[model samples]
Target: MAYRQGVTELLRILASAVTALLVAAPSLAPAQSSQPVLEISGASFRPLPIAIAPPIAVGDEAAAADEIYEALTFDLQVSGLFEVVPRKAFLADPREPVGPEGIAWTRWSDVGAESLVKFEVTKGAQGPKASFKLYGIASQRLDLGSTLEGRRADARRIGHRFADELVKHFTKEPGAFSTRVAFVKRAKNSKEIWVADFDGRNAAPVTDRGGISLLPAWSPNGAELAFTFFKKSMEYPNGHPQLWKANLGNGRSSAFVGRGDLNSGASYSPDGSKVAFTLSTDGNPEIYVVNADGSGLKRITHSEGINASPSWSPDGKRIAFVSDRHGTPQIFVMDADGGNVERLTRQGNYNQTPAWSPRGDLIAFTARDERIVFDIFVVDVATKEVKRITQDQGQNEHPAWAPNGRMLMFSSDRGGKKSLWVSSADGNVQRKLGLADDGEYTDPAWGPFTK
Candidate 1:
């Protein structure tokens, strides 16, 4: 049965190519703007200036321990929340405290160091253990101290956790540098789903069977995934593509919706009781709400034109979606019950794939250059101001916000092929995720941390 379903989806894709072209007409033009707006906010307090002394080596010599220290130092510097002072300027080693006075606070202040990070690497039975201490120059006291144990192979992860703790003690927000990303990859005739750590390590495929699997949406708890798959050859066999759910813990999966013409673009609500999805079961693609268990299906939009890609607001009272009821695809907001539809994007000729941020203050979506390319953009819900997050790249689309709403993940073809990329919510730090050979990753939905 699954084999037949896969073949049917492929026929639908070929048949829908003409309709897609018609709906995507206006997107073929180049978007023009005199200047682009970039969002930047100032921190409430000045960042602390700190120094990290070279780690003190203990026992036998080991190159892996030294490499771990170097990577940790680099992580702290790139976070942009700290100013690291040079270790060469330290007058005394932390291994020898100058008298009980705890080193000279005046000397550190003179050298422009407001804090100090001293670490000692010791060989343990299991592996290496790094002991660290943080000292504050202003208070003239030790602020924090701890020891972390890990195998030499996991040295980088240990370092990242240590740096995260330091940031939390000072900034009051957990650092996002240790998170992970999940995305879909497609190359030529092979399609697979994968998950990787934030730094693009330990990438492994979750699915081995190659069929037309697309549009992966992570559950709020990050334990399950909802996506669309094409497995049959019949033309619109059961109405639309089928939706399936996969449980990451046990590798169990099952069909969620199969009676529709197209059951794609599914997202879980913040509270996790319901799912917002795009369905064409009613003849025209429209936004629909259904229980997470696939019961109590309810249509939310009654517009005459195409309406799809529904994303629930953080409060769960409203939903953001893409609609062509205005003659072109644009972002629209509607009540969860399908009342009070309002247009959100007036300037962009083609805007689609609306995703509400978990923070509840903004909505991110893909805005195409009415000429030839697509880029990610965000809209402030209260102010109604729009900010383009990606510049001229091959094609950037399918944006999903992080759990904290401080970062976003999307797919782009900038490096000559489609790959997943992540950026700060403000568009400051943008970087690619996944191996170069992974090939054409798309539809990245950032999931919440499970542990």
Candidate 2:
């Protein structure tokens, strides 16, 4: 039941920790909308210039409005889709009316603001009610608007919700702003699972078991996480790394695959019905799949060399994994039933930790180059073209795709101490996620959008 062979070395290869924050859900209400949607093409992409006026607050909601403004501004800055004009550049009043008719379009246009945003927050019986409006400067028309009622403690969520709507209005798809990223927070003698907001806000631990935990994976529903846990406790004096599932709602964890000699690299299917992971039950590490509750165990890879890090395709019809059978660790893919296996990455001799994108077009992975430095890369699933994401970044690894597939989060020591970093998939925009300076974090798993 415990991994007595190669477990210690494996632990060193996949070490990580965690932090998280939680808030109550808020109700949504659709406001006014009229739009000549913005069309953005990658070949000729330019960040949209937008001005966000200071949020107006009524009654005792100043603090809530400020929180919402901070969160919303951060979300847009990192989105890679907009250039948020600075407040210092503002020619218009910060306390502008939310209605389109009362707006001074000429002043905003003078500052080169293609679009403008205005919001107001009022104290509500339930909490804080935030109303948002987006204006197209050229058209001088209201493009999109929404009102979200959230708890005062969750004013940040209200901001995130409006940001998501802003993204959807232009891209026709929801933004990943409302999602969370789960990472392993490493301390002196402990490694725990932590979930932070997509922007790395309000990070706190979700796991407290005294053990080595790594490679956290989010369930499709964003309600649970499956990670590898190794602990030497009363039941098992010998520490073993096995897959464990943690419920985000109640902070409860249970063994999902405790029978194997080693269980790691848990990946949930798109439907959340089953999980694909690495198991070493037969002495050789290989990919395996089982029901979410740890039933119906089935081996997915039968290889002499190590096979691990199974990532499920968005359609739940295929899996991307790592294998060393071809003489070097490389990315590989196979059908959901473990048939039709094919190699994915042919460029790197030491490529591993493949994470299938939600769009199913690219698989982000970690590769060691001739310089012996590890960095993140993504391979086009259809064309087999490999694109390096992190260059000369300090030991970047464990690439986890954002829910929208437009961006990804990876662990890097570039800022020192192995913190989480997010990057636009094209490697054009990158930012270090704001995490604590004292702790080491790794193995980021970006969660799906919350329901």
Quick one: best lDDT, which candidate? 2
lDDT of 1 by residue, 1-451 (tens): 9989989998899879978865533222222221121122465534457877667777852464576566566556545456677667776655654222446667677878877776777887677888777776665555677788788776666676787777666665666656666778787786767777655566767666567777877887778888887656567543347788888888877788876678888878888899988888668998888999999999889888899888989889999999999798999998889999888888778898898998798999998787768999999888889998899767999898876676788888899888888776766557776466747788777777556
CA lDDT, candidate 1, residue 409: 80
TM-score per candidate: 0.78, 0.87
The candidate that wins on TM-score is 2
Worst 10 residues of 2 by lDDT: 18-27
Say what the RMSD of model 2 is: 18.3
Estimate, for each residue in 1-451, the C-alpha lDDT of model 2 and write its tens digit: 2575578766665553111111111112222354545566557778889989889999999999999998888888777888889889999877667766567788999998998888999977789999888877776666677889888878898898999999898888889988889999998888899989888887989999878888898888899999999957676676888888899999999987977578888999999999998888778998889999899999988879999999999999999999999899999999999999999788868998899999889999999999999999999999999988889878999999989998888999887678988887777778888788878999999989777
